[model samples]
Target: MNFNQKELVKSTVPILKTNGTDLTKYFYRRMFKDHPELKNIFNMSNQASGKQQHALAGAVLAYAEHIENPEVLINVLKSIGNKHVSLNISPEQYDIVGFHLISSIKEVLGDTATDDLIEAWTQAYNELAQIMISIEEGLYQSNLKKSGGWKGWRAFIIADIVEESSEVKSFYLKPKDQDLIGDYLPGQYLSVKLFVPELGHEQVRQYSLSSAFNPEYYRISVKKEQNNSNSPDGIVSNLLHGKDKGDEIWVSAPSGVFHTSFATDHPLVLISGGIGITPLLSMLETNKNSLQENPTVWVHSCRNEKVHAFKEHINVLNKDSQWLTTHVFYETLSEKENTSVKEGRIDLSELKDEVLIDNAKYYICGPEVFIKVQYNSLINLGVAQEDILYEEFGPQLLHFN
Candidate 1:
C-alpha cells in the first residue's frame, strides 16, 4: 500500500480498539447472509460463542497497528494461512470476504466514511488479501507435493473407536480408498468436517493427531464437550461422538506450526492439562524410540484418574523406557496411588530438579488460563522466553509481553 493508505489504516487504530469486535461481528453477519454456503467451511459453534469475531477483531487491530511494516507479521500470517488451508479456503473466497468487510466498514462508519477513507481501506484490504492468498497457495502446493497428500478434503472411514476415558474417545481413521496416508508432524492437527443435523449445516473442527506418524491411519482423541449454561454443546464433537464405526467423514491434510523437532538431543519437557494431552502424546510417542540419550518428562494434570486418558499406555511407556519420566496431578484424588501420582494442580516448583535441566525445551498444551499460568511459572523459574512453546486449543487470543 502507499504511504497515505498506511497512514489512514494506522489512524483507525483507536476506533478499532474501541469497537473492533462490533465491527467484526457485523462483518461476519453480513458475509454469512450474502454467502450462506461458506457456513460449511467456518465453525458455527465459535461464531455463536463470539470467539471468531473477537479473534478476527484482534487480528485486524494488529494488522492496522503494524500497517507500516507488515513483514513483521509474517509468522502470524503463516499460522493463519495453515488454518485457512486446513479448512480448504480458496483464493476466490477472499474476494467475497473483502467485499463484505469493506461494506461493513462503510456501513458502520456512516457519515464519517469519506471517499478517501473507503478507498484507502479498500487498497489496504486488497493488499492483505493478496498476501494471504499467496501464503495459502504456497501451503496448498506444499501439501500437494507431499507423498499420498492431496489438495482439499478427502474421505476417511472410522475404522475403529476406542473409549480412552469417560469423556474422551479415540477414533482410528483410514482413507476410504484404502491408500497409504501422508506423513505429518507429530504435533500437527487435521481438520474434520461433519454435517450437523441440529445446525442444518456442516461444521469444521481441528483435532490434534494423538499418535505418531503412521502410513496406514490417523488417530484423533476427542473429548465430548457437554452443554452448559454458559455455552452451547460442541456440535461437531458431539456429532463425532455419536458416529459409529465405519462411518465416513471428510478430513483435511494435517497442518500446524506447533510441532517439535525429534532430530535434536536436547532434554524435552511435555506438559499438558486435561484433554490438551492429545498433541503432546504424539510428541512423546514419536520421541520415545529415538536412540539419543536425552531425557523426556511427561507432566499431565486432570480432574481425576477416571478422566485421564492413556493412563495405561503412559504407564507402559514409563516402565519400558529409562529415558522417560512421568508425573500426574489430580485436582481431587480418589485414592492413594503410586509415586508418580500427586494431589493438586501442576506446580513447577515441585519438579524443578527434573524440569530445569540445561538446554531443556518446554512444550505446553492446554486452555488459555493454564497456558498463561504455566508460561509465567516457567519464566519465573529462569527459563528463556524462546525455549518455551505453547499451543492453545482454540483461537490465538493469548498475548504475552
Candidate 2:
C-alpha cells in the first residue's frame, strides 16, 4: 500500500480499539446474510459466543497497527493460514470477506468514512488479502505434493471409536477411498465438517491428531462439550459423539504450525491441561518411537482419573520407555495409587526437578487461561521465550508480551 493508505489505516487504530468487535460482528452478519452457504465453513458456536468477532477484531487492529511492515506479522499470518487450509478456505472466499469487511467499515464509521478513507482501507485489505492468499496457496500446494494428500475436503469414514474417558472418545477415521493417508507432524490438527440438524447448517471444528502418523487411519480424541451456564453445548463434538461407526464425515488434511521437530534430539517437555492432552499424546508417542533416545517428560493436569484420557497407554509407555518420564496432577484424586501422580492443579514450581531439563523445549496446550498460567510459570522458571511454544484450543487469545 502507498504511504497515504498506510497512514489512513493507522489513523483508525483508536477507533478500532474502541469499536473493532462491533465492526467485525457487523461484517459477519452482513456476510452471512448475503451468502448463507458460507456458514458451512464457520463455527457458529464461536459466533454466538462472540469469540470469532473478537478474534477478527484483534487481528484487524493488529494489521492496522503494523500496516507499514506486514512482514512482522508473518508468523501470526502463517498460523491463521494453517487454520484456513484446515477449513479448505479458498482464494475466491477472500473477495467475499473483503467486500463485507469494507462495507462494515463504511457502515459503522458513518459519515466519517470518506471516499479516500474507503479506498485506503480497500487497498490495505487487498494487500493483506494477497499476502494471506499467497501463504495459503503455498500451504495448499505443500499438502497436495505430499503422498496421499489432496486439496479441499475428503470423505473419511469412522472405522472405529474407542472410549478414552468418560467425556473423551477417539474416532479412527479412514479415507473413504481406501487409499493411504498422508502423514502429519505429531502436533498437527485436522478439520471435521458435520451437518447440525438444529442449526440447519454445517459446522467445522478442528481436532488434534491424537496419534502418530498412520497409513491406514487418523485418530482424533474428542471431548464432548456439555452445555453449561457459561456456554452452549458444542454442536460438532456432540454430533460426532452421536455418530456411529462407518458414518462418513468430511475431513481436511492435517495442518498446523505448532508441531515439534524430530530432526533434533533435544530433551522435550510436554505439558497439558484437561482435554488439551490430545496433541501432546501424539508428541509423546512420536518421541517414544523416534530413534533418538532424547529424555522426554509428560506432565498433565485434569479433574480426576475418571476424565483422564489415555491413562493406561501412558502408563505402558512410561514403563516401557526408559527415556520417558510421566507426571500427573488431579484436581481431586479418587485414590493415591501412583507415586508419579499428585493432587491439585499443575505447579511447575513443584516439578522443577522433573521438568526443568537443561536445554529442553516446552510445548503446552490447553484452554486460554490455563495456557497463560503455564506460560507465565515457565517464564518465571527462567525458560527462554523462544524455547516455549503453545497451542490454544480455540481462537488465539493469549498474549504473553
Candidate 3:
C-alpha cells in the first residue's frame, strides 16, 4: 500500500504481462475447478473464441500497470462492473476471482513475485475490487432509492406489448411497486434476469432502452432468437416469447456510459445495424426537444422492412421534425419493394453522403464486425477519431483501429 510497495507492484506489471495469458488461463482453471457453478455465468463459447482471453489478459495487465494510480482505471473498472452486474455476479464472487488471480500471479512469477510483491498485489487487488464493489453498490442503491425502482430484481408488470416485427416485440414495463419509474439518460441499457426452468439458474441479458426516458414507464424491444433444433434455445428470449401483457419480469436499473449528455451542440450522427437501433433511438428521442439548431441524422441498416423495429414511431418523428433525418438500408429488399431506400450494408460512400457533417459527434452500436468496418470507414472519411463513440454489446473489447 506504500509508495515503494506500489512501485514494486507496478514494476511487476511487465513481468506479469509476460505471463498474463498464462495467469488468466491458470486462474480460470483454478476458479472453474473450485466452483463449477460459475461455468454457467461466463460464455463458454466466448472462451472458445480466444479473443475474450486475450482481452482479459490485456485488461489485467493494464490494471496492474496502472495499479499505483487507480483513478486512471475508473472507466475500465466501471465497464467491468456493469458486465459483472449483468451476469448477476456479486461482491463475494469478486473475492473468489481475486484470490485465484493473485495466486496465479504468485505461482507463475515464482521468486520474482516475492512476499513484498504478493502483499502489494493483494492490497492493490483489494483496493481495485473495493472500488468496483462500491461503484456497483452505488448503482444498486440509486436504482432502489426511487419510488418504482427498488433493490434486487423486482417484478415489472408488462403494461403494454406491441409486435414490432415477426420476431421482435416491444414490451412497455411499469414497476409493480409504484407509479413512478426512474428517469435515465438516452443510450443506457437495462439488465433483465429470468429464472429459466430449462437453464436451471437465472440468466441475465441486457436490452437497450428503446423508449425515451419517461416518468411513467420503461420499454425494451426483444428479438426472439430462433435457430435450428440442434442448437440450444436462447434462455431469456424464449421465455419472453410466451409472456403476455399481464406477466411480470425482473428488471434492473438502466446502466451504461454510452449516453449523450448536454456536453455540446455539435451535429449528431448515429449509426446502427440490426437490433442495435435500440439505444440510438433512445438518444434521438431524448434529444427531440433540444433547442439547439444542430441537425441529427440516423443511418440504420437491417435485412429488410419486416424485421425493422419502431418504424412507425420513427416515421411519426420524421413527419413532425424537420431537423431529424433517418435513412434505412436493407440488405435484401427488392427494388420494387423499396425503391426509395438504399440496399446494402453501411460503407464509407453512404456515410459520406448521409452524414451531413464531416466533424459531427458520432455514436455507434452494432455487431463487432459492423462496428469495425464502419469505424474504419468513418476515420478514413475524414471523421475525427475522438468524436466517434461506441458501445459493444457484451464482454468488453478495445475498439478496432
Which candidate number maximizes TM-score? 2
What ranges in model 2 sit over 4 Å off?
A: 336-339
Per-model C-alpha lDDT, please? 0.89, 0.91, 0.78
lDDT at position 58, candidate 3: 79
Pitting candidate 2 against candidate 3, the one with the higher TM-score is 2
For each of the candidates, the C-alpha root-mean-square deviation to the true structure, in angstroms, is: 1.4, 1.2, 3.3
What is candidate 3's lDDT per residue for 196-266, written digit by digit as tens? 67646656678899877878889998888786765555667778878999898888777777888633377
Candidate order (lDDT): 2, 1, 3
Clashes of 2: 0
Please give the distance, in angstroms, between residue 388's alpha carbon in candidate 2 and its true position after superposition: 1.0
Model 1 clash number: 0
> How many clashes show up per model?
0, 0, 0
Which portions of model 3 miss their true places by more than 4 Å? 2-22, 32-55, 84-93, 107-114, 144-147, 228-232, 262-264, 289-294, 356-359, 399-401
Off by over 4 Å in 1: none
Measured against the true structure, the TM-scores of the candidates, in listed sequence, are 0.97, 0.98, 0.86
Q: What TM-score does structure 3 among the candidates reach?
A: 0.86
